[model samples]
Target: MPGNYVVVVVLSSLAALVLLLPPLFAAVDDGMRSGGKCTNSCGNVGFEYPFGVEDGCYRGGGFNLTCNHTYQSPRLFLGDGSVQVLDISVPHGWALINNTGMVFNSTETRVVLNRTWDQLVGGPYSLSGSNKIALVGCNARVDLRARVKVKHGGRGGDDDTGSNLISSCTAVCPLDLEDMTPVFAIGSGGSSAACSGVGCCQADINLDIPSSYTIQIHNLQELGGSISPTDLVFISKEEFSYTNDMAFGNNIPQALPALLDWYISSDPSECTYESAPDCLSANSFCHAYDLGYKCHCSDGYQGNPYIRGGCHDIDECKSPQDYSCYGNCNNTPGSHICDCPRGYERNASTPNGCKDIDECGHRETYQCYGECINFPGGFDCLCYHGTDGDPRKEGGCLPVKHHLSARDLGLFIGLGVGSGTILLLIAVGAPFLSRKMKDRMRIAVEVARALTYLHSAATVPLIAKVSDFGASRYVPINQTEVTNAVQGTIGYLDPEYYYTGHLMDKSDVFSFGVLVIELLTRKRPTYRTDQGDSLVLHFASLLRQGQLVGILDPQVLTEGGGEVMEVALLAGMCTRMTGQDRPTMREVEMGLENLRVSKKLASHDTASSSLVSQMAEHRMIATGDMEESSIQYSMEK
Candidate 1:
């Protein structure tokens, strides 16, 4: 009996899992009919739902597993030799799977893994959601296409709210591939060990799974290069640790019960035509699938409507615990009712509805709290002294004037005036504020110079005249404690900079990117959590896909087509992490001159702007100073 109950529980669990299907399940059209004898078994594993060996068994398509009986024990396998699944986990959304003996060497510092969609050889489904693409190697670069779900765009973090986004994470590390080392961080990097480039990598999936996946591992020294051939790529169903040993470079995830979903796209005409009465009762709704429509009782009812017998009504009154009632509960055939207790009069409108009798008017049932008021729904509990009328929301009402009379107020004002005089006297000699202001001005000038010099004179003239001169030279904002919350202009802040307050021209480049976006479209570099769109991100996405015209500012697009593309590419270069990689205003000028001299550019030139000229001067000073400082430091060391 215990075993029988266990079997039933197991069956129920499996049944519940089949409810959510993948997008590909749009192909299935029929229910399965297994005549009698169960066929193959791998030890304790039984072939079922999606793993049957023959046709007319699986409920959908794209799930094919082969039972290898070549050895004494039978083993399940995917087509060819992609992954070897070890076990299936229903409670925890994972499958114990691993890749075969392919290895990759970590000659470079990074490797890549992918969470790809697979159609188990025309069986009946595809796996999805938060699947981990594990790259067991050192120095990994995991580039992923984390797209938004087609249906919904974002994920809600709280328990009650809906989700907002399907996200992906990438991890990296550097270690000895043959040492079996965990590849933890070597020293101190600002990033945590979780993703601090020591060894492991992970990415989050947006809500929807794409049709397929593209994967590549790049060498930081140069792109489109690979490490030695000892590393292995695996899409794990669970978390996996990296080993520094030679084997780890080649260890892939073990294949097992990878979870996939099946969907009934439309109502099945076959099932509906074959069993009209039994399939869909008067009270039921028809769900058309690829094969045929399956029948079920109406929303409020449950039972076997697929059989000859009629679907029975569910009695909500059978158990008082079934329905949510505020007071006395009464049962009906398909629903329940509630009634208030004795002294409370029955309310005709709401269920379990009741109103308290006005006993205070009769001077009987309630006690007093300052004063009592009799109302239709209930009695009011009035309170005094730091209280309000409603005991729940506003505790009680207060009688004003227990502290601070007019005399006390006047005395405090006199004290404040005395303190103000003393502070003003100190302010007369305070050099700290002035010093700080000078430092801020100094930093601002440096930044202004970097920005100006990097701009092309022909495209954006470097004007020396300061019109919007919000910044002053030789004055330091550092003198004051108040800081810059957002240092760069909207378009130019680096996307890579977050959580830290470090400021420099690189951050300004991020802002410049925003400016480029503005030049392309009329939008600013603003982010709305409610609406998932960023001007910079939108433009960057277009550029990455080589869709320049789609994002180019219409006005600019009409003026110059080919020139716009070159400028966009230049803007991208300016945002590079290495500030040295950015072109100096002079270099930018030479590049621009090439186009103008070639007559491929517009005749008008705005490159000699004074602002840009000032920027060029500032850069000349700072870059020379920094380079000399670094060289001296190296010599001293």
Candidate 2:
């Protein structure tokens, strides 16, 4: 048993040791990969990965740099030369260098020429296409030449063709300084416009796989009568601003800022799987350039791509300017999640991703059956007008009861009795007039009821009523019936029917228009204005001139508000001079019905309040409660 136990213990210990070895080795490997002796910064500029001041730290010989410690502040240079390095971007693969310009002078016999350049043969650095070649001075000319790479040949050869000459420009001074000064003042604000061939000229450079390049400048005019100013030619980086003083004054810079592009390879072939070794970082990708390849961090990653575990996921929640999140934001690996608050929703139109949800627009979802008012994130529901309760639920609101005084009720009954007595006396005194008025009122009610039924059913079936066979005539559809005598009342007759002795449905429309005018004005159809014009004609004229308000009844003005004008306009259309010009009976009915519906909607609150008041008064009268504290009355006696 002891022998068996010993073998078991040995086996268990070896299993534990095997599991621990992998992580321990990984830690040591990570330390060795990150540990390197390198100076990362010089003066005010800093750089990382791929570019290093020490020999073994950089990725290749072309990326090697030197740090000069001879000055008060250390200065970094590209290779072992005087070309000082001002800035370097590792991810962008570009560097800014301080480069000097070439100057030329005029001699007694001829023009003296000068040339200045840095050899870029067999190196990672290439002149950026964004740089501009500028010539500054009177009658100055400058030429730029390059040795381009050839695809078929192993090495490039010098060529004097136009393709090799990348850029050239000439500058001339204006004879009148006064005129040029104003133009120069405006151009000095921008660099491209400032070099307008007046004492300065600029030309863009295009280099197609250049192995080497040179610049030469000389005076174009003969040096005989007047000695020209010292001519200068230089290359400037993208967006480098030039001013009038720099060209005219003696403040021209000895060196200008230049951009140099750097890449991984010089070969033009596409990269293979084996060539992706440079993008060893966890979240890095390899992109093919025109002449070589470059490494870049993935979409949500940032930092150096040439080193292992260099790129890191970005925290989008902290960057509000770049990534908008209105509500709670949670960051995850390589991405982020944004959740809007309770009553908000996603909207691209808003600056933030979230916007307030209009709960009132979607009433069913919010369970608000009554009046709903929307706020920022929530809504309020209540009974509109007078009744009170939670309007969000069905059948939650109820009508309230009101009371009136006993003395006020008595006074209301007395007025009713007196009005009835006066009307009874009038009816007895004028029996013929009263009968005619009653017959007309009955006819109008029947017509209104028929129109209401037709609209409610949404279908039209003719339902003719014959009050008097003498005045009624059957006219076929789409036909006119002629009569020897017009039988309608003088004030309500259609002018075309009376004059032409022709009758149609439009004749009834003209009479209805007169009736509508009488209803609104509370005047008889035969009533005339001071000018002796009939009510229909006067109403039409007043409606066209927007003066219907003066003739409208006080009751109509109080109840109709703005809607009265629409009805008046419809009446004017129905009362046109010719029966053919008037609207059909069906059209007049629809117009009146539409105006009525609009009025109902507009006065919804007011009508509700009035109904509640009337109901309360009836409740008081039924209960006979005179001294109740809650009861209210319009009159006391």
Candidate with the greatest TM-score versus the true structure: 2
Cα-based lDDT for every prediction: 0.38, 0.55
Which candidate should be chosen as best, given lDDT against the real structure? 2
lDDT of 1 by residue, 324-369 (tens): 4556666554455666665577652355567777755653345544
lDDT by residue (510-623, candidate 2, tens digit) is 666665666567676667778666676566556555578878866567556655665565566556666665555555554444444553554434423433343334334422
lDDT of 1 at 517: 43
The TM-scores of all predictions, comma-separated, are 0.31, 0.50
Off by over 4 Å in 2: 1-36, 101-118, 150-163, 174-193, 206-211, 223-225, 238-249, 268-275, 324-330, 337-341, 346-355, 367-373, 380-637
What's the residue-level lDDT of 311 in candidate 1?
A: 49
Worst 10 residues of 2 by lDDT: 1-10
Off by over 4 Å in 1: 1-55, 63-123, 145-183, 186-197, 221-233, 237-258, 264-637
